[model samples]
Target chain A: MLEFTFSVILENLLLATRWTILLSLIAFVLGGVVGLIVLFARVSHSRALRTLTIGYIELFQGTPLLMQLFLFFFGVALLGVEVSPWVAASLALTFWTSAFLAEIWRGCVEAIPKGQWEASESLAMTYTEQMRHVILPQALRIAVAPTVGFSVQVIKGTALASVIGFVELTKAGTMLNNATFRPFLVYTLVALIYFALCFPLSWYSKRLEGRLNVAR
Target chain B: MLYQMNFGDLLPYWQVLARGLLFTVVLTLVSTVAGIFVGTAGAWARTFGPKWAGTCVSIYVELIRNTPFIVQLFFIFFGLPAIGVKMGEAEAAFLAMTINLGAYSTEIIRAGIQAVPYGHLEAGSSLAMSRWEIFRHIVLKQAFMKVYPALSSQIVIVMLGSAVVSQISAEDLTYAANYIQSRNFRAFEVYLVVTGIYLALAIALRALLRGIARAVFPKG
Candidate 1:
């Protein structure tokens, strides 16, 4: 009942890339905001906040994103609230990204020399002021390259949103495979598009990492 | 209005859950064994083997690292069938996990290999150690000692990632959850319970791996 043409398949997949791109952007921007809060909580002197942030990071890092997506997708409906795959996916990925980004940023923060903290403290800067004026600026510099590097991971992660019926690139591949019965052509195109999106970012991440290594 | 939660319904699926956990453990153990071998060899080749070998390893690393694991699994399980390379679900899942872990550990292991101080290698050479002997006793051992923590984390990652293998109906932990939920119409309870199990497994697995690392490198 359906014909599988190369042009037709490519067009459909190209259209699907829009959703993938949008999901990645949504997850990344929102995750960054949440991650910064988490990072601050982690680095602060409050023991309770530190433990809470550690749990947040470990819980997200320990579980598979796929399971998180499943819980979000189904867990909401149990509360008599209806949720689309879009909302659930965004929520799950945002939290997942926060956990990872927070840990990454914390590492960069801790990597700063101890003397910087001492100097800031001696200047009578308040807790927030010390972090804001002194520590964060230097930490932000170290954070940039790794932050960019992790975006590639975020992009690859959007592919999993398809598992919850979000209809991104991987889901599009499955749909096309069903329609065309051409797994090789459809999946190869799918992998190629993913490669095109990811390789440049990975290469850039590596370059930045090299630069960071040289600086250190 | 809040709905009352019921986890009691999941109690009837203990056997299925146990089977799934066993399967996950087996898959991760096998993959870790094979994956580390692939990584060690790839690292060795990149470090000492020919230029073409290094290129092959680099390409392999980037390709696997850049793509999503689910896509890699699908390509192996679904797409490979088109090329007349048919594999059972379990076999395909195993191969995919091994390959995925291999690519990641290659980079991890390579970093370890690089961390071996040059003087140590020279010291081995001074002792009249053969190439294989130097690599086996000095380079590989020290590399493992230096990078075991990172390698253990990666292994746990691969273990958690094995959850995706259930998509191909490999009957791992997630599959057990899927089945239990379907049977009881208690998706939320089933998944939450299964998530707890996974968390426990990850903690325990990390501890176990650390124990092994301690044994392997007593000085460490």
Candidate 2:
């Protein structure tokens, strides 16, 4: 058995952080786009669309993300398409992130008073126009803190993508542990690296939350 | 050859699946009860304990809250053995989830504690109540009442996260799904079915927790 050197484990672990960062960025950005569409559909006038969007949100949020990743990996393969673990992981994380983001955004939207909706309606603004002009701007302010808060969740979630074999930080830790036979050192370092990535975001969210409350 | 779906092959394995579900529920329940005790204590330390105790509690909560639950489980299951501390998979899973939920509930319970009015504590003091009596009789119930809904949600999230322990071969619900899929060569169907089960489990767990919350803290 190879005795593990601190530098070697640290070096490999640092190198893998790039995958974690990139995966989080891709999932968050794409999920935000999808989440925005889901948010609009959820708050739409059409009863069917609202209910369908709610179901979509609940379906993703109510289950383990690991299961979703498994489904996408095998579901794509079943459709006769070549599916990479990277693609499967991304798709799973994206949907999971989108569902959460939609719910968070909806909470913010609901914080807006009914008067704003009627004001826009009285001005003959379309539903799209009202959201774009009157409601979203105000909701966006309330949305900022929770949106940032949810990003921490999304980032930590990338860890699960490792299970689908996307080779991010968590996977890197496992590989290092296997190679070095230093489970304690390697896993401790992995948890620390994640803590380093996550703590600042959590702090920022807390700070934003405080500021948002003060302004209100 | 085309891909075929067969959930039928899994039907006979219902006993195995039942075992997995039992383990998951048992783990969730054990951790939840112990974890809440830890959280309530941690919250007390933060509120009324000495300065050092509060600092230590802060560090514990932040560290656990920041890291993913899977890593926490892996460290307990895989890492501790390196230190000559042996633990079975179930033991490790229980410890990990207890720590994870403990940190979260510390925050929730602390919020509940803070929301207790200063006047009430003073009123208790004027009535010659001991700190313990005041905490147990006055603060605890009110805190539970205020934060019970939030606590209910956290319990469900923890139950859902219990799925990850299956990675360490703890034979949780997800592990059963993996096992059935591998044996039957029906991965998608198995996962889909398991996903539905987990979703239902989350809903059921939330409802159960909410019911408990209502029973524990009567309307004031």
Best by DockQ: 2
Q: Quote model 2's TM-score.
A: 0.98
User: What is the TM-score of each predicted model, taking all chains together?
Assistant: 0.98, 0.98
**Model 1 chain B, TM?**
0.98
Which runs in model 1 stand beyond 4 Å of their true positions?
none
Candidate 1 overall Cα lDDT vs. reference?
0.92
**Which runs of model 2 end up more than 4 angstroms from their true locations?**
A1-4
Error at A110, model 2, angstroms: 0.4
What tens digits encode model 1's per-residue C-alpha lDDT throughout A35-75?
Answer: 99999999999999999999999999998888999999999
DockQ of 1: 0.78
